[model samples]
Target: MSTNFTYFADMSRKGIFSGHIQAMVYDRSKPFNSLPLLPPTGIEEDVDILKKLVSSSRALASVDGKVQRLPNPSMLVNTISLQEAKASSEIENIFTTEDELYKAVSDTIQEGQASPSTKEVLRYRESLWEGYRRIQEKGTIDLDGIVAIFSKIKNTSGGIRPPHSLTVIRRGQSEFRAGEIIYTPPRGPGIVEHLMANLLDYLSDKVDPNTDPLLKMCISHYQFEAIHPFPDGNGRSGRILNLLYLVNKGLLNHPILYLSKYIIVHKDDYYHHLAGVTQAGKWKPWILYILDAVEQTAKLTNQLITNILEQMESTLEHGRETIKWYTKEINELLFSQPYLKPKLVGDRLKIASRTTLNKYFSELQAAGMLAQIKDGREVFYINRDLVKILEG
Candidate 1:
């Protein structure tokens, strides 16, 4: 294969070295160009619309430092729209429910539960939920809390966090090398200094304290990823930075922006826009994409929350009629923990025997609020209506 090389000044007059890579200066005035930068195609354009809606949905979900409640209706609609696109997409191994994705992201951040394999997804959900809660209470974002999210998503496949090295592979090659480095950044010296300093400046200057915090977050995300300074963890760190930036701007009481869901769904486009900006200095397309994502995500999220409420209300009405004794208790239990085990019901309601808990759950199932997923020793109950509400 043909090789492409870049060289820097030698180590005598003024030079530095770190890692196994070497660098050199290139003519800055030369026209730097890459492959043809094209706008989204027809199918991609359609998907892009959904991506925008989901992005908006996520922004609206922010707690805004405990000053705002749940996202407004527009936000819910966008969230649901994005979810629909995700479910309809032909991508393999994609999560079908908003709950599954949200739970995965939230749990990871809040509990610090590391996935030995992709376990971080569960914690992702937990952490995200708590992030929203924090917004409600504190009315600010939390950077450190957001950064702890990646430990949970099990690195199953598809390179969750690729090392900061130029990747090279022909059409059919399976293996690759890491140390074939090039493209030295404009920093005088030190990697973290160049990236971190700019980030801190943007956070202080460009970010408007009052204008929609989520919008500011999208800007911060673009700036961080463009720098791509870290040798590793840049992707994950950039993402985490989104949540923290929101917190810093006081747009959310909790750092619960559902960005990854949209990004993961539109993974190809996300990369495409980022590359377009770096290669061609094209910012409009990326900015539009980010704005669109925030708008839609927020709308869809709000709708899901509404759907959940409706489902809960319907279940409560049924419980009042059939399961009279523990109707309120069971309803509260479902609201608190949508994923319920028989033992959990028994424990929460103070029921003595497994038999009684089973009876209560059976009553809920009969009333059409809950459904059972059973296979040998593992028996789980889902609020089917609630699931339906969220996906819708």
Candidate 2:
């Protein structure tokens, strides 16, 4: 909590906290116009943290830009996207086993045909790719793009929450009596749209030249989450926006450096830092937390990329040494889909028949390069080492 950084509390209601809405009900009118804080001052620690964030951002950008040079970079994109999907969805308590997720990925065109958990994870990946495509096409971010991201995550016709929607942040496993409200976001016929408009400006070149783009991104994330624009999918959407904003600003060439797994591991601090800003005007801690997440997740991702490359090399070597024949194309296919199918493998290697591809899978499995797992009656062969690396 910073005594110097000043923040005004929106004269919002606290009934969401205690679940008592009689005389204690807050009118819920917290105006947030803190977007263009020129200095964003009050925290003496921000200078150092900002420097660190700049360096860390560059370090991440280095590998992200170089990873594209790899032979099969989409492997990282798809694998990282799915890992991020799983972690981000896990934050919402949507759980799926590793086997279930990999098998779901092996399925070609897995939109509606999956268990609820697996389907939801796949939607996150789909929406992320969609968001990436939109940003690439338009070279800008918009509310509709975000709506598209969330709609896929929830698999619905999604958009901003309507003013009449009684969407309050709460946590529980039951009905109205399940849990007390943690926060009540602004409610109005146009509050969400209005806030989002201001957010769009900050994300672009029109505002706050003094604040670094990365700093602006941290502020943007907090603002988006605080706005709670949608009735559902806000968390996943906000996270997707984080990466889009980075790519939009050219901080990352790809979305491989997502912070979901890191945030999931430090979820307590993630929420606490956000709450610290709202409760006591503590901006430095929140800024530092996000910067730290960027730094740490970048390191992990760089290492993951390194491990992936090394494993690819080792797999090639092992195949050539132990088997009578070898093809880098075949191994690339296996890496492309961690859970490999004979049809997918055949398509990649120009083999037409499943009967013939089965021989290849058997050879790979026999050489200790692939492991077979049966989802039901259908068996799926996977690169055991690669899957383990991805599951990390």
> After superposition, which runs of candidate 2 have C-alpha atoms over 4 Å from their true positions?
1-45, 109-113, 173-178
What TM-score, over all chains together, does every model reach?
0.60, 0.86
* Per-model tally of clashing residue pairs: 86, 1
lDDT of 1: 0.47
Q: Mind giving the per-residue lDDT tens digits that candidate 2 earns over 314-373?
A: 989988888876878766777886787787777766889877787878888899998988
Q: How close is candidate 1 to the true structure, as a TM-score?
A: 0.60
The TM-score that candidate 2 achieves is 0.86
lDDT by residue (tens digit), candidate 1, 1-392: 01111222232113232111122233322211111111112222345544664555455654232224433433332333234333322122333444444333222242243222233333333333444455556554433333333332222222222334432211212224434222223232333333344455446553233434444455567656545444333455566556556555655444445555666668678867865555544555676777776556555445555565566577778788776774655675665544457766677667788777778778878877777866355566776665555544
User: In angstroms, how far off is 281's CA in candidate 1?
Assistant: 2.2
Candidate 1, poorest ten consecutive residues by summed lDDT: 31-40
